[model samples]
Target: MKKRFWIAIPIMAFGLGWPLLAQENPTEPQPQHAQAQAQPAVSAPDVKSPGTPQLDAADLEAWLDGYMSGALEQGDVAGAVVSVVKDGRPLFAKGYGYRDVASKLPMDAAQTLVRIGSTSKLFTWTAVMQLVEQGKLDLDADVNTYLDFTIPERDGGPVTMNDLMTHRGGFEEGLKEILITDPAKFITTEKYLKDHMRPRIFPVGKVPAYSNYGTALAGYIVERLSGEPFDDYIERHILGPLHMERSTFRQPLPEKFQDNVSLGYMSASQPPQAFEMITSAPAGSMSATADDMANFMIAHLQQGRFGDARILKAETARLMYQPSAPHEPGFTTMAHGFFSGPINGKRLIGHGGDTIWFHTDMNLIPEEGVGFFVSFNSRGKNEAVYGMRERFVEGFMDRYFPDKGNEPLPPAIQSAQADAQALAGKYRSSRRIDTAFLKLIYTLQQSTVIANEDGTISFASEPGTKYRETAPGMWRDPNSEGALHVSTVDGQLTITNSKNPVSDMQRVPLAESAGLNSFILFGSIAVILLALVAWPLSWWCRRLYGQTLGLTGRDLVAYRLSRLLMVGDMIYLLGWYMALQPLFQMQFDGFGTALDPLLFTLQAGALVPLIGVGVGLWNAWLTVRSDRHVMAKAGSVLFAAALCGVAWVAFIGGLMSFTLEY
Candidate 1:
């Protein structure tokens, strides 16, 4: 639910036939607080340079109105909240549309609590840093030392708290109990992490693979050291100090704030979904009013002080600001917990949060003492919130802290076609399962880089954006000024760009390219189905025409055996598809324990191709060597080859995996 960029498909475009939710004064925003009036700019110690526009509440609110009005109407989103803080003062806060569509309850910037997803991690990180400020936690020590449960060490070393902070713990993606409406599936962070511990696919402190379990592990550590629940520890140390009164990490929403929580929707045109329960609560489970979020953001912007309260010390906050992994001039890096980057000529630290329905983004400019937070209660048609958040934040930056122009291209741009060509290929995200059936899903979502007819290249992820080589291996997008840094690592090209370093893209070999995999998948299915229909139809046609019995012999036996193999292989493929169809629909119910029997059946059925393909090869040999008709020989060879492809695909795709870890 982090809205990982690896997925090219829409996030929550749940298909429904219901009419759009009705609203009174649909175009006009209903606010708990009226539109802010023009007021003098809040006193900031940092003065603006010449020609900088004054950021006042009236101007900010008016600008937000022009944007959100059309955005909600066009995108079919129900409601949203936006808050901006300048220096140590809140500059603007407003809500747009309805919080409860059925009751026509308007969204309230001060009262409507919206689930802020992974933004919850920022609070968790603050809690951990506070403990580190005391002597309760060690940032560099093995995390296993802090836990009652053991997390086995991966290659190089045991996962340290720093590794979890930087998201370099190398844990494979955890999908079970991620988002569930079933309260029965709801489990604590400790229970989920302990029961469903993931294997480390990458070495410890190496490769950026986003892991919710890692964050949960960190949260659990805080839970153990503080002698309290994760949620309570967060509220007492971080939220309480920051005075984020409306916020709570509690799953069901504390009883008092329950009525104020906004209903999340796949789309405003569709019915509302039940409250999303995140088992990995530490990673992404917190709801708060936009105004409360502003307070939290103000603390970070002012070096962890909010009025009389302090959540993180100045030194400790600065430590969080330090990049855990810095790249070349215009590439990506991760701070201790924040995503630190060079954006619009300013150093920015921020994090994006996403749930199944709600989408949220938070950003803070330490140098400017400016913080911005926005949340959408609906994913909208085609998950429009994802692009909306990025464009909104960047638009704000361009409007206020305007960049002077694009960065000057390096000398390498003069003749960097060769390097650009070298970078053009299929790339897969490193946050992938190494050995599980889930890898098949990752394969389909792999990214591609194509060398344009011109000297520029483009990433499939950022369509329409062309990047020219600004440095030897750095391709800079002129539009966004984001650069992608590609280099060979361990004999394969791994790319780290201006995007967050939660994951990097690695070059995919041609044999394992998604294109090839898709080709084999569809082509084999087509061939198998064609063979299946023809075998039955051809025999019926021969009998209808009163033809001979095809001269019964080993040739007949081979033909019959081939049909049997097709039947078994086809059944195997379809069975797996039936089991996995839910995932294709972007639902995770099929991954729960309830589907274990179906999964086991599919895994056991993998033996179909394992044995059938061998028998198919023998049948092909028997038919071909028997001086059969030219058509018969060709059909036998093609049939055998098609089944062989299916078998190979099954093997490499991990359909043969007997475990349900994926």
Candidate 2:
């Protein structure tokens, strides 16, 4: 087990809060059971559709009322705003529930503002495109060309704007100090970029690891090229033109818009927390109302011009909406800033976002000149919010654009059982913590991709979903028609839903192969606890019997020292766990330098158990030489062995490493 200690440490980490980290398959456009013959592939906004009845306004309103009212009550979500735009006009824009529950102020879709989170990246990307249209920026050029400080080339390749836009820049995901509670600590974009440059874990343009840092770096480049502050550049070139008067990217928002800001809650029952200050503001910080967002969406849907304001030229806008990376057949691809996928046979480009306590989604059906936006004020950790978003979109699509049916694909692969077996295993997301005890979460919660004896792969994390090999190394969900492309890259088993592999779940070594560490850990804890209780009882029993048969001197001292070591080990584990408990409850931005002292103490204290290993071994040798029973000698060896296993597990788990930087 000691020799196998190095197997589990993966150099990866993920965001603490949502900032577009999870990559879900795009919604299927055609129903799986539809019998219509397959039609030729269609580009976005131009998919041919059998004409259907237009959505009735009154019926839509009634349906929304029923769904929103029920969802708000059942999910315990505080409030929400819904906006729908079609044919360059606002079809619906309204708020449901309260904006400020204590004051009983109702939400106002045109006035009340909520944090838009990662969806704010659209504005940053839009600004970049505007500059590119003017030849002030280059999408394919090395980003270092515009930066004051050079970004070191990885594998002889410089990261380009295209790589950043497509989320294939290879930077490891970041979390620490990314979100700060205090506005004062929210440093400038340049400083934030410099202080938190992540290590590149994948080669450029190879993987799709969602990165807030990469987005922020793009924003910084925009600032440098435009010779203006990022917020100012966006306001002048994007927001101001679109007449989004109620939207802002500033933290602690401008005084006039502050009162309209909706409070964020963990749940409807929980008290509201203060507005968070995103350290990477360009990635996930923007506050806007439903109407303001509607206006912005209209601009994108209409080829960059909204009313009299124009953000990007037609060609640039078209380029921005196009896929930046390759994708699986029948799957969505990464656009410049948006995620483009099919819905009800209609091509849609959209973005979804989440702050600690707010969740939102925005999608545009360009051909229909329609866009939908929904945002909830509560985080709703039970994921009721996510369910609501998916259901709402699906229902809306089904009603307005019911599948005309499509030609079914060819027969499923029925002879790939061997291939399926080869791919079966427990796999962890590449986006995970490497240097912190948080890494244990991935180890324990990795997805189990099982190869069924039947020629299908069972995705255990999402039960009821299975895949069949549609190609040599490609699998497709027969029901949804979504695809999963797999291959071995650099000896790692990589699985991707789209063109770029987002996660590589290396085959985990069997527990037995890894020195049987899991069993050793369990046995060690059990043995040490028993010894802690039994040692004291043994001493008292001897005193009661007035026996002097036990050994003294070095043996007694070593025995006493071993017991003290167990006390230290217990204190370290328990103390560390207790300290981390309150942290999980605190706001995402609330963790920072304040947590260093306790973490350092716990790390330093874990070494005490290593001392126990030495003391236990000494005691074991003396106990065997003494006039002790055979059972007593066996117990000594077991206790000493347990001490070694305990120390090894702790060390490998990073419980003993001292680093406050996370």
lDDT of each: 0.76, 0.71
Clashes of each: 0, 8
Measured with C-alpha atoms, the lDDT of residue 487 in candidate 2 is: 75
What is the per-residue lDDT of model 2 for residues 1-662, given as tens digits with 9 covering 90 to 100? 00110011121111222111111124412112111012111223534345744555576677778888888878877788888877666667778877777876677777788987778888888988988999999899999888888775677388999888877887766556767767776777678788767767778887666777888999999888889988888889887877787888887678887777899887777788878777778887899988789888777877887776678898999999988887766566778977787765777787777777777778888877778898888855574665666677777777777665545655566657888888887665655555665444443456678887667897785667677787788887666635677777667777876422334455555541223555666688888899898978888888999976365788879878877887776676677666556346655564566666787787777778788789889989988888889998998888888788778777665566566654
My TM-score estimates for the predictions, one after another, are 0.91, 0.86
After superposing candidate 2, which stretches have Cα over 4 Å from the reference? Answer: 1-53, 150-153, 404-415, 498-527, 544-558, 609-642, 656-658
Cα lDDT of model 1 overall?
0.76
lDDT of 1 by residue, 40-62 (tens): 12334655568866778887877
| Residue pairs that clash (backbone atoms under 3 angstroms), model 2 | 1-515, 12-432, 13-432, 29-344, 29-345, 36-406, 37-407, 38-407
